[model samples]
Target: MNGAPQVQRRRGFIMGFGAGAVAALGVAALIAAIAGDFSGSNLTSQASQVIRDEYFKPVKSSVLNDASVNGIIRELRKRYDDRFSHYLNPHQLRQFESLTSGRFSGVGLTVTGVKRGLRVASVLPRTPAQGAGIKEGDLITAVDGRSLAGVPTEVATARIKGPPWTPIELRLVSGSGGATRNIRLKRASVAVPVAVGEIKRAGTSKVAYVSYATFSQGAHGELSSTLERLDRHGAQGLVLDLRGNGGGLLNEAVLSASLFLAKGQLVVSTDSRTMGHRDYDAIGNPLSQHPTVVLINHDTASAAEILASALEDHHLATIVGTRSFGKGTFQEVIHLAAGGALDLTVGQYFTANGISLANKGIKPDVRAVDDPKTPQDEALRRALAVLAEKMAVENR
Candidate 1:
């Protein structure tokens, strides 16, 4: 989710845009000029609402000389209820910038809020997070001097992140063994990779492992580059890992699925009042012919669900993992006045076959939950077996 929104591009969604704002004010103004009982409290509330909804910033006080108008705008703040209203001032804007860039001055690990606390979901490869040995499932207790019991996930992330070359301390409890560790790191500009590919033998079958960390700004380009490398490295069978990955961009999901499907094939479908489909048939695709198996878990959400559902519906790959995180709503960011932006869930996505997965997530054909400490690699093993059979049939 893009936490910060740009207010200029969303003129369609915000009603304050167009003459409607002025018109709304004009209606109030006309009434103010002729209405009876001008000193009544109810009229005062009504006038204040006019200033808040109709009046813009750096106002010409001479026009809205009514004190009631000013009070309505300031005291009531009813304009914020429009869903398009946003309050992202300069400070909020800066925080959003850091989140989108991916290259933040921090320990370089993506953490999420859970029942346990702020837990380290995945330690980005080759960053200070990895160097500090912050494993997946490590519940963070504190950062610097702040306690991490009730703060927002972003706030906790900001606590651990800072300007380049600054020091930050963290206390953690491991999910694997309940072991505790205290580590201090010098935050730097962490360069997160787009796609991660490793071609190795999985016990007995030769399955290629491809993990996507996040859908960052340049995700499509980065994923294409990674696929090229994997193709060169002799990846005939694929294990596309999507566990613990909260989705990034929407089109990136479509583009990533496009690489593995033929032209004119459906990738993902969207729902408005009616259903609509987005086709993925870009020319000169890379992995469209390869037999791929997607690895998913509970954390797979949004764009991840889109990609998984697309491939399964199109018969491109067999989804193998626990049930997905079940987030099927797509949000559209609308720019608001006052410099902030609004992110509203405007659409719902379906599989390529047009089966909506809004509240219900995509169910894997093969259910597997891989937990090493407890020793259950059910999903992975099933996927490996399927790929092994595929390879055997192809070789024969």
Candidate 2:
């Protein structure tokens, strides 16, 4: 279960500083910032002093180089209590870049952090994790025998991914107390599609079912193509399935929203302290004006939330299923001079109606609970019924 320790070992030299004292000073500064006089500049100055002078560990001049500085900044960001802010070293940065490219080598599982530990949020179909029976809500204790408990989701993800055809073992326990078991899975290159569509023959008309995996750079193009094909197949209505989607690029979200909205419609807007205010407008022709439904669940987040909120606010689609994951903040990746990068949450985004889906997610217009016993999709069935009723009324 042991890999390289998360914390790097101190190699030489002794610094004449007490780590306990410096950590206390940091806490004091944090308290002061909370109490008022909270300038980011002041916080940065205090942090610099603690790292340069107060840290208990010896500070080597050679280690003070860019790479070490980046590492220190990463630790500082964690202390800053901003969960969305992250510093990626060069290797981690490359790994991230690979994810956004729509292809990567991994066990095909997505995870998230919670109070208990790292939990498996979803597993992609036909992947190694799915084949090994990894289920949602399973608490992942360790990767390759190394305990991932208390580790950040990003770090855990890094540990799980590797070159294709490599084997990685995951030790996990059920949501409830159960036997701890390890499952070995071979990592494979996963080429994720942005969106996939199929026409379902429902009574007199066909219902277009489109499921989007992530809002990567190619999302808009994929969405457009799918919509076009569905329309050609005489799809009378649409079910935009976004369950378990964690979301991706902001621009892709806006573009996806544009597929249902008309030109000049505001897709999303942002309110920021550092970057000021900004708005995104739809510029493409809508695929159809027919009745549409958006399927969402608790795992649907970030860019996916943006699109759902926009469509719901505009009364363009009837949202069914459960509440969304409520992640409305957007991050900006700033490349450091040290070949690494910093992803900082710089702003909060709002729907077309100016509603912020931060901690409070968007409520579904039609709440449909999941029915495990039914062979049919409960949410999809409800959505199809709603669309059918709408179409009937329109014909009248």
lDDT, candidate 2, at 12: 27
Predicted structure 1: lDDT: 0.66
- For residues 219-250, what per-residue lDDT tens digits would candidate 2 score against the true structure? 88998899899999889888898887888888
Give me the candidate number with maximum lDDT. 2
Best by TM-score: 2
TM-score of each: 0.68, 0.77
Tens-digit lDDT track for model 1 on 95-185? 6557656566777777666544577767787888888878777899887756777444444555666678988888888888988778888
Poorest 10 consecutive residues by lDDT, candidate 2: 1-10
- Model 2 Cα displacement at 20 (Å)? 19
Q: Which stretches of candidate 1 lie over 4 Å from their true place?
A: 1-90, 101-103, 113-117, 141-159, 171-173, 177-183, 202-207, 272-288, 372-382, 393-396
Deviation from native of the Cα of residue 243 in model 1, angstroms: 1.9
